[model samples]
Target: MKLKLKPAIARRPRAMMGKLASAVRSKIEMEKIRRRGGPARIRKGPPEALLGLRRFVANPRQFGGFVSGPALAATITREIDPAAGPVLELGPGTGVFTRALLARGVPEHNLILVEADPMLAARLRLAFPQALVLACKAGSATPEMLGGLRPAAVVSGLPLLNFPGREVERILAAAFSFCTADAAIYQFTYGPKCPVREEIMARMELSAQRTARVWRNVPPASVYRITRD
Candidate 1:
């Protein structure tokens, strides 16, 4: 006579099979990534994009729920001058624009990346060892924090529209605090109008001009160049 198996024991084989299938799928995906030159090689694009999505889901207001595509980064940094001096990037989530900045001749050491997310900041530090990666909010950044380096241009990926009016001014004020007199801040927004409020701009004596638009991004975005009015 055969003995009857308990319910939990009977389910064990099915669960094991499921786990095995999952492991196989993971292995196949990893093999694909390896063929494409491994995770480190593709870190800049795919992995970071996925990381950004995860961050966005964790905090929609903070991350804006969208990653900046290469096209948008290219558009935002189109007019940047590599020789202008140190480039400050605000909210550089997966560093899409940072890569563009490097491609445009900006020295890796001359880049200042401000990321509030500690994980992203750590990754950035690993990705750009020479670059200064600060894990803090944009509004909280100060000249002292920058180590007395004045950025000639600020490439912002911050979702300014999602922030409060006062906070927006604070962030902008902080960004321009140590910048050169002629320095311009480049910001991108998904809205039809400028992300920075008119009153705030007037109060800060700043003027914004729509420089470019990239429709290839997840949500079409407009780049604005903000300068002293």
Candidate 2:
């Protein structure tokens, strides 16, 4: 006797199996790198893309469907001054922006990366051994995490639109707490406007300006520069 399966159910297993195969391949590649290694050299393309996609499927609200492209990363970090001070990066998924920051002359040790995903956080540590990687949510960021260094600017990759207003306020408030007087927080959103709402900005005495729109991004995104009013 054979059991019949619905199309939806049959399709789910195939998708899961495909993801599993991808995970297996990623693991094999990691193992190869580990064996051949001095420092763990995880290359910067397909593996990270696969991991980002898996995390996106698991939690769309927290992880967007695609990683930030190089153009998007470069655009967002364009205004950042590497000589100013420490750079606080939230949701540094696949460290695309982190790499861009480095390219812009920000030293590895001057970066403080806050990533919520454990797997991604571990990879970040491996990928950037000199930079500080904290595996915690954006709202949980604090001065203590910075270890006495204030951030000159914040380059956030968080999906703030998916969060509630209060949480958004909290995250921004925390971000500003340890920042310099001239600091600005740079955020990108797939939406038509700023991801951080107006009320939250007003309440915090913060102001936002749309800096750039990158059509090259996967879904096309707008960059915003927010600073204290």
Worst 10 residues of 1 by lDDT: 38-47
- Tens digit of per-residue lDDT, candidate 1, span 1-229: 9999999999999999999999999999898878867353327556667888899989888886256787998888888899889999999887788899999899999999999999888888878889999999999998999998999999999999989999999999999997999999999999998999999999999999999888999789999999987
| Cα TM-score per model | 0.83, 0.84
Enumerate residue pairs that collide in model 1: none
Question: What digit string (tens of lDDT, one per residue) describes model 2 on residues 2-99?
Answer: 99999999899889999999999999978877897755655677887888888888888987636689899999999998899999999987788899
* Candidate 2 deviation (Cα RMSD): 6.8
lDDT of 1: 0.89
Error of 2 at 45 (Å): 1.5
Where in model 2 is the C-alpha error above 4 Å? Answer: 1-39
The per-model lDDT (C-alpha) reads 0.89, 0.89
